[model samples]
Target: METTTATPWLTEEQQRIWRSFLGGTTVLMDRLDRDLRAAHGLSMPEYEILVRLSEAPGRSIRMAELADAVAHSRSRVTHTIARLERENIVVRGQCSEDGRGVSAVLTDHGFSVLEAAAHTHVQGVHDYLIENADAQDFIAMGRIMQNVVEQLHGKNF
Candidate 1:
């Protein structure tokens, strides 16, 4: 004889937490994007790309690596890099190891731009998430998010 298991539904408390996470994340991201735009004339995605490039070795990374780092599609990364290139913030070069691979190098201007924008982004994060959250709760949230990321992304990455 075989037994069938029933699907479990979320409890009210679980549902509440899930909804709050969704809404809060949306609002937080929107606020951060708006703050970055108003302060530095950079969109959040562009800022993220610059940040990743700046942190990479030699202030450069392969376009595919950048897309993976930022969780964006290759096509989207290409478009954003093109926009940054036009602004003289970043330039693409043939990857030394593999000529077919493309690398995005952050220009001095790009580093300066990221430096100027970092403050606004940090403060927005603090204002929207950190300052408002309890210290213990925030740590717990971090752990929970790490678990989620590991469960969802660890295998693929």
Candidate 2:
């Protein structure tokens, strides 16, 4: 004989909020990606990777670190980097310090592309979310998402 535990479920309000979050995020991400693609020929993930490289010291970072920074899998980052390399946006080279690690370096062209794309991305973010959301609600949403990220990642993200 086995004992069974009852499954916990969300309350009606909780379920409604969760569904809203899911739908809203899906639409928001799609719009952002579409805008970037239309204006810059860049996908959201690629834009994120370029942003990470741009912020790193020397505009370069180890491939593993880049993947981690973007919260993407190593293989996914590798594939994206490959595409960027083909476009002459990024180049991969051995890390000078260790010589055993590979790093992705953003080319000057990549930076220029990013600069142009930033305007579109930022405006989309503002027009779709920030401008429409109440300031206090936006701040609270940020805090709530940060907490969720910390819980999931086991550290502040």
Candidate 3:
């Protein structure tokens, strides 16, 4: 027979902090998404995809790799890319090195859109989170997030 230990509940302080973190993240993302959509007609996820592609060589990335970078499923990336393609922001191409692989190429129009939206996104980030936070606290928060990412990603607890 297998035995299992009961999980401990979060302490009061831990619960409070966790809830605050969750609420803050939701608010921050909502604000950023709203700002991006209002100002540049881009969703947060689309902006993220553009950022990733813009940073890639030749402003292109294999679709599977793009999906992984954004932490989205392949189907979601495909759907999003289809939307972007309709807007002339991105185009799909077969990877030269591998005929079976498809790549998302950021169009010139997409780069221009991203350039305009980047300013709003950066300002939103500063206004909502960075500007009000103490430098030491912000750095600590970043480190904490990094640790959480390392702990939760690609492994069982």
* TM-score list, all predictions: 0.93, 0.92, 0.93
- Runs in model 3 with CA error above 4 Å? 1-4, 154-157
Model 3: weakest 10-residue lDDT segment is 148-157
How well is each residue in 1-157 modelled by candidate 2, as lDDT tens digits?
9878789889999999999999999999999999999999999999999999999889999998998888888899999999999999999989888867899999999999999999999999999999989999999999999897778763435
**With candidate 1 superimposed using the best TM-score fit, by how many Å does residue 42's alpha carbon deviate from the native?**
1.2
Reference-based lDDT, residue 63, model 1: 92
Candidate 1 residue 60 C-alpha distance from true site, Å? 0.3
Tens-digit per-residue lDDT, 47-142, candidate 1: 999999999999999999999888888899999999999999999988987878999999999999999999999988888899999999999999
Residue 135 error, candidate 1, Å: 1.0
The Cα local distance difference test for each model comes to: 0.93, 0.94, 0.95
Q: After superposing candidate 1 on the true structure, give the runs of residues whose Cα lies further than 4 Å from its correct spot.
A: 154-157
Evaluation by lDDT, superior candidate among 2 and 3: 3
Assess candidate 1 and give its TM-score to the true structure.
Answer: 0.93
Q: Could you report the Cα RMSD, in angstroms, for every candidate shown?
A: 1.7, 2.8, 1.9
Summarize candidate 3's per-residue lDDT along 1-157 as a digit string, tens digits: 8778889899999999999999999999999999999999999999999999999999999999998888888899999999999999999998897879999999999999999999999999999999979999999999998998778765545
Range of the 10 consecutive residues with the lowest summed lDDT in candidate 2: 148-157
Best by lDDT: 3
